[model samples]
Target chain A: MSDSSSILGSTAAPDREAHLTPAANKLYGLMAEFESPAQIVAAAEKVRDAGYRWWDCHTPFPVHGLDQAMGIRATILPVLVFFGGLTGTIAALVLQIFTNAMSFDLWAIVWVRGYDYFISGKPMNSLPAFIPVTFELTVLLASLTVFFGLLLLNGLPRLYHPVFKSQRFARASDDRFFLVIEAKDPQFSRTKTEAMLQALKPLSIEALDS
Target chain B: MSTLVIDNTWDDPAKRAPLVLNHDRFDTVTAEICRVNEEAKPPMAWYVTFGISLALLGLLGVMVMYLLATGVGVWGNQHPVMWGFPIVNFVFWVGIGHAGTLISAILFLFRQKWRTAINRFAEAMTIFAVMCAGIFPAIHVGRIWVIWWVFPIPNQMDMWPQFRSPLIWDVFAVSTYFTVSTLFWYVGLIPDLATLRDRATSKVKAIAYGLFALGWRGSNRHWHRYERAYLLLAALATPLVLSVHSVVSFDFAVSQLPGWHTTIFPPYFVAGAIFSGFAMVVTLAVPARSLWGLKNFITLRHLENMNKIILLTGTIVGYAYAMEFFIAWYSGAIYEQFAFVNRAFGQYAWAYWIMISCNVITPQLFWFKKARTSIWIMFIASLLVNVGMWFERFVIVITTLSQDFLPSSWGYFTPTWVDWLTFLGTFGLFGTFFMLFIRYLPVIAIAEVKGVMPQADPHYGEEGHEHESEHAFGFQPRRPEDKEEDQS
Candidate 1:
């Protein structure tokens, strides 16, 4: 048996399209729900063509090719991660050389002097021996860059998003696929948007607002 | 090419194993994985196991206190056998962590969909196991107070750590490994955490989950970036995993000791690490699946596939053992020959045999499908494999250092009560973290699991919808109270 959560509210506001005043409607957006990926993907393509730049499609997981449907360009996260790794490699290389090969008083909170020495009959500046730490540092910095870069790019650690306003959108992380056309979209006309969403034949539609 | 588990009544061609079984809709997959965390109480066995773990954790605490107060002399580590139980435990626990990384990082790169079911669990195990592993090394330095010397922060002593030493390399490798693994695990948890945040039944749960969820709304724009970052992490971790174990092996291979100084050690150690790590995974997964009703998610196919890897890696381990002996004898060096002969037939011969039979012989049973699929057989074999692996580390450490090249300086390494308790207590440490993890977090990656289901495909509705529609009942929407939970 299904829990109470599984019972979805099917609010079909089809006839309520386009007559309301702008002052009467204070909305985050109109979120159109569909049961399957095919529906939402097909609907996303239409929304993209209609010039809704601020719109987005929400799904439970990474919907393959949905980015293409929404016309999302490939992220520059990997390129940044590469530079991050490069920084780490140079940092490790300099640190090891400065400490192991030559002593220098560097600036931080205080001037800390590097201790140059030799051991294991190996050269004072041993590149082969330094590779392991360098490699690990490269990976460490690259991984950190990927995570922080993603958060910065995505504008995350955000406490709230307007999409969470709709009770229907709760299923966005579960089964439902939602196409949200924000009120802030330049092409947004309250009446015209609902009329366009109606043409997509969504399972349900919600006009969400603060 | 993406593999789809078709509704295989007839006319199916690709014939790959189903990733998720008996679940038609995406939400049910969410429900099942979340149910374990949302339930008010876990099964009775959880309490029993948790209690034992806590008590053992207490023992570990007491032993650490005693060692710090008294001295390193409380352990059996003496002149020749300076690296004893602590090093053995360190290597064993570290090696055990590799399986999780292999599952999470390597398999993900290879696009193995089955990894989604168990990757979270394995990664959690990796972090906890590393924590236990870290404790042994930190304490074994004999001076716990000046442990910061491991770092390159300039000190009043004007002394820096030896950069060319394998020991310093290990410090960097392991700490870096731990940090990267933790970040990787957290990143994977974001979508799943958001699921918990949305479906949270309480205010506290919602806030806590929401904070970590980082306001993930599964937007295509965000998912597009998230997926790319995840791929980058996986790629970075794949090499990190190999390097971590190879650095650990360098702790031995770079040594002048006859048994330890072999070029074969790196690949051999990596293979053994994966072998033992998979063994531990099976051991943990077997009881866990049954206890949590996760059979459908971590299906029989997943277990069978793991058993196949165990068999493959286990054989490689055996071959390495044979090759080590051949390499030792072929070099025609008296000390190398003596080291190999002494390992097989000398003082530590008993421990060597345990390693052989447990690691080599036990996994060979998986060649039979009955052994692979049977819960009892695989579980027992896994337990044996863990024992064998621990002994494998024991044999490598103690045998070489005990007698080595000088018979007069020979010593028999034996564990003191503190040493034994500390080693046993790490299991408790590992178990405690694991128990809390399973109780709180979605034990499986809910979002990743859903991604593999057929319904996630854009064309799922177009292909054979009739077969799925019958079972796609109760597939939509939220509970009445969900709004209050969210708004609160």
Candidate 2:
């Protein structure tokens, strides 16, 4: 998992082709096109069982059970969002306390602050008045975390990908489903992988170049 | 063969009308929606409307500049009724903003499949309405230049916005609502943008759409995370929808004013917000669906469903009004009794009557199926509801302030030309943004709409001999008999 995460982060940058000569650039992967989401799910299960770590399924919309088929673990986004909400809550409390309730004073020998200021005859550190801002800030941070966390987890903002260079790959976002097994996978062998995918009765198979 | 007796149960699938009509393939769904952006040139009517919206946008800019330069006194705000048109428009637009989030986040959470047809534009409307709503309070601060003081940024002045005040809570609530809503809208747009990117005929168009798509290749892993993020956002936004209007209500309910200070304001304001928001959706959608040639996608069923919501929320709001009066009477508070009585017979009596007739009376027509189905009736009712909601805020703000505890301070509030233009300019600004959005983006969510269609399901029509007839891409060929049934 750590190895895959490292690869996803840096080494597998899509633009690495710019550094290599035309002759040195190798085939990125073999992409098999499937007719339906069911077929792709079946293929994904097969690929997962075959112990191919660097393979992925692509579909027009999310297939209900594809995550299980691909052996993809549940995301850690909720935990991150939880911490974010906690941070927001603490920050709101500290900010409101320091700004509204506590005031600073200078003595003859030393300075002192944190004197409580009362407004509207209400007690200092009014918990009820703090609830709305605390709640709002918590939602704000948690939602922002969800958005950015998804992007980071997906390793997105990848404007170009080698798989996109395949002519048949355009249909992946329209009406077709695809399964791509990259050459970098430990289990990948051109002849064996091609024969294995061929057994799945895919619509077509194409080699994607880097 | 043993005869199978199909039970006619209340939960029977045969009783329901299909959500998607004229069942088509996945490819057709993409082609139909993308064709609007690809093949259909902007019509003369589109150009003319865009032109008018742009002129209005220019007018909005001029009005805002004048308001900032000449000061807030250009409007009708004065002693006793210092909170005038600016606050009225703010609450109105903010209330109008609620329907979009309700339809998008709340409906999405409830597993309402019908939301797919209109959720995209409804979410866009949420973002645009918030933008319009945010403009009012920023300018209403009087000292617009020092608006940053609202934030708790550390400064040499050592002064922070009073945290105990509901007004300060409103700043956090509204800004957070805007940010979360925008994120939800944009995240949903990425897949559809990819669809547009793939279909673009020109290189320039392709790159532009591609950039926004952020290299989305629709990988199942990515979709997994995307779906999770979307669900979390919807969960967060649900409470936010409740909190935003509740805090806005706190702005008034926390005050000592007779009409404004009521425990009922929270639920009352929230209900009114949803009511007005749904009305605005109907008002905009009725013409938009027809004008854009989107009758098939934004079907009459969607309109009927929305009208039913309008009916529901309208009743809730009317009930709240009655309860407010009943509570006032029940409490034996003389001031509260005077506030309610004065509202119906005061100088703003005309506005109060308009509010009741438009909000309570007009939506009751939706009780008849014919009225709900009829486009013209729904359109007129929706417009009336919009006017009623505006007057609702007007009556609440003006009437309460006009007849306060001291008879010496009593005065009628009249909006000046600047006040009227600023309100009109927000409409212009909202319309201008909406027009541009409709032109450039796929207004209906292409991917989400496709997700709801029959073909997208893995188990669609897998029973009996029909299993063999499952065509490629999960699209079963429509037989002549099936076509006839669909037509009937």
TM-score of each: 0.92, 0.91
lDDT tens digits by residue: candidate 2, B258-325: 98899989999999999999999998888887777776677778888899999999999999889988
Which regions of candidate 1 deviate over 4 angstroms? A1-25, A107-110, B1-14, B461-488
| lDDT of each candidate versus the true structure | 0.85, 0.83
Count of clashing pairs, candidate 2: 0
Candidate 2 error regions (>4 Å): A1-23, A104-116, B1-15, B464-488
Best by DockQ: 1
Give the TM-score comparing model 2 with the true structure, all chains together: 0.91
Q: Chain A vs. true chain A, TM-score per candidate?
A: 0.85, 0.84
Error of 1 at B289 (Å): 0.7
- Who wins the lDDT comparison? 1
In the predicted model 2, the residue pairs found to clash are: none
Q: After superposition, how far is residue B412 of candidate 2 from its true place, in Å?
A: 0.4
How high is the DockQ of candidate 2? 0.33
Q: What value does the interface RMSD of model 1 take? A: 9.7
